[model samples]
Target: MSNEDVDSRRRRFLTITTGLGVVGTGFAVAPFALSMAPSERAKAIGAPVEVDISKIKPGAMRTEEWRGKPVWILNRTPDMLKTLPQMDKRLVDPKSEVDTQQPAYATNETRSIKPEILVLVGLCTHLNCSPLAKLKRGGSEGMEGDWLGGFFCPCHGSKFDLAGRVFKNVPAPTNMVVPPHTYLSDSRILIGVDKNKKSKKSKAKA
Candidate 1:
């Protein structure tokens, strides 16, 4: 690697170390080595991540990093959940039949393993831009009717609802992608891990 590249990687390492409170702890090499895969492109798509989500309050959103990209965890209100199905006719891919955006297990009313909590990659499908959270009713006025809540991409005027479903005539062609994930408990979620692995691990223990 070039000197600049080395410096950048070092900086990232320092940042992660500080963020994770890894100081004075014994290092585990296996998981770190496993995370570095055979291809960068594959690694970019999915990286295992464990997150403690007990702090987020109702009607709030929290951002987490996975595969060097931002992942959003939103705590939706009861009213927000009610707005999703009502928005079907107004959204481009309302049914969430678009396979590219999320896994089959997550293709549901809430678009998640658990209702009232939505997990999605925060990048806009228009041109990979990060969309700003606009969680208020009647978004922008021009869209017409009660807007409920959602995200708005600044790059190309793409708009997504609370379910992350892109609006018609927006720059984004589909909803924001939902990375593979599983809920370890009511308060803990493991992103980048799927249900099949959980089954395998369960079988091994049995």
Candidate 2:
């Protein structure tokens, strides 16, 4: 054969070999690359969320998704605060003694760092269903007269007070979970993390 023809054949062989090597390397490394990358479930479970509460009006509620769960932020009014104590006798765990449900800083009557601002998991303790806001005094949509602005799960008639405390005789055994949270500022809060003065305890307990 001619030298030129031999050189052309050699070049073609090198090109084909290089392409096969690249393809083989990609197949060998693909599994490791996927393993190193975070799964969707892992990302959903540990992501932290920051929320702005500056524009949340009194008695209004805002919900944000974190770790694939709904975190509710309620701006309580004077009227809502007044009703909390009155419903204590009717609640199951009025004092919030269930230590597993909230951080130490949030183990208060309002289940929050600030009484005026409530942070709670929107899911009902009975079932994982999110509750509907019945934030109005008196009965609405089959709730009784004593319903003084809280959450109600229509799925099973489970009721939670303004502070997410379960009421007596309700299907829910405990109050709504108060997720680990800390105030970033007067008008902002971080969910899924407690970086406050008591963060160590909060992290341990939560």
Candidate 3:
């Protein structure tokens, strides 16, 4: 064979070998890159969740999960809101005085950004037990006849009122936590983020 022919064959062999090596390196690195990406479970655990509130009718509630804990979104009816003040004298934190339990904007009578829509972490402050929604008044959920809409923790008999305020004698020490959240629109809310206090202040100033 001519020297030129031998050199041409050697060059062709080197090119093919280099291409194969490149393809193999890409295959090897692809899985590592994928593994480095966050998993679905990891995202679910810490990512912000957007909730659609349009389907939740007044006087009804919907639950969503964040960080492995249940979060409740309650659409309080006019009647339900009326019950909040009445339970104040009977509640441990009627005005949400415990600043740690909620953001500054939510430390109000309703314990929410909006008076009609309440968002709360469903776990009891005492034992982290999920509370049952006893949202009907007058003992409908097996409480006293004058029971206003609220939650009942069967685990330790802790009672929370319409605003997630703990009753005066309940096992839970503070009101249910109001997670940091903001309204994306009239019918959408994003949990795990604080509402824009600056905008609220500007509106108030206006």
lDDT of 1 by residue, 1-206 (tens): 89999999989976675655442111222235445666754554455766767878989998877766788999998988988888787788776887554687566767877788899999999899999898877737444347678888889899898988888988799888888888888888877888865787899999
- What is the per-residue lDDT of model 3 for residues 1-206, given as tens digits with 9 covering 90 to 100? 99999999989966665555444221222323334556754554566777888988999998876665788999999999999878878988777876564688678899888899999999999899999999998876788998987999999999999888898887899888998889999999988877676567789999
Cand. 2 Cα-lDDT:
0.80
Show the lowest summed lDDT stretch of 10 residues, model 2.
24-33
lDDT of 2 by residue, 1-206 (tens): 99999999989966666565454221222333334556744654455777888888998998876666778899999999999889888898887886564677666788888999999889999988999999999876567876688999988989888999998998899989989888889998888887764656678899
For model 3, the local distance difference test gives 0.81
Q: TM-scores across all candidates? A: 0.73, 0.75, 0.75
lDDT of 1 at 13: 79
Residue ranges of candidate 2 with Cα displaced over 4 Å = 1-36, 196-206
Ranking by lDDT: 3, 2, 1
Deviation in angstroms for 83 in model 1? Answer: 0.9
The reply for model 1, stretches above 4 Å from the true place, is 1-46, 139-145, 196-206
As a TM-score, model 2 comes out at 0.75
Weakest lDDT window of 10 consecutive positions for candidate 3:
24-33
Report RMSD (Å) for each prediction in the order shown: 6.3, 13.4, 14.4
Could you tell me the C-alpha RMSD of candidate 3 in Å?
Answer: 14.4
Q: Is candidate 1 or candidate 2 better by lDDT?
A: 2
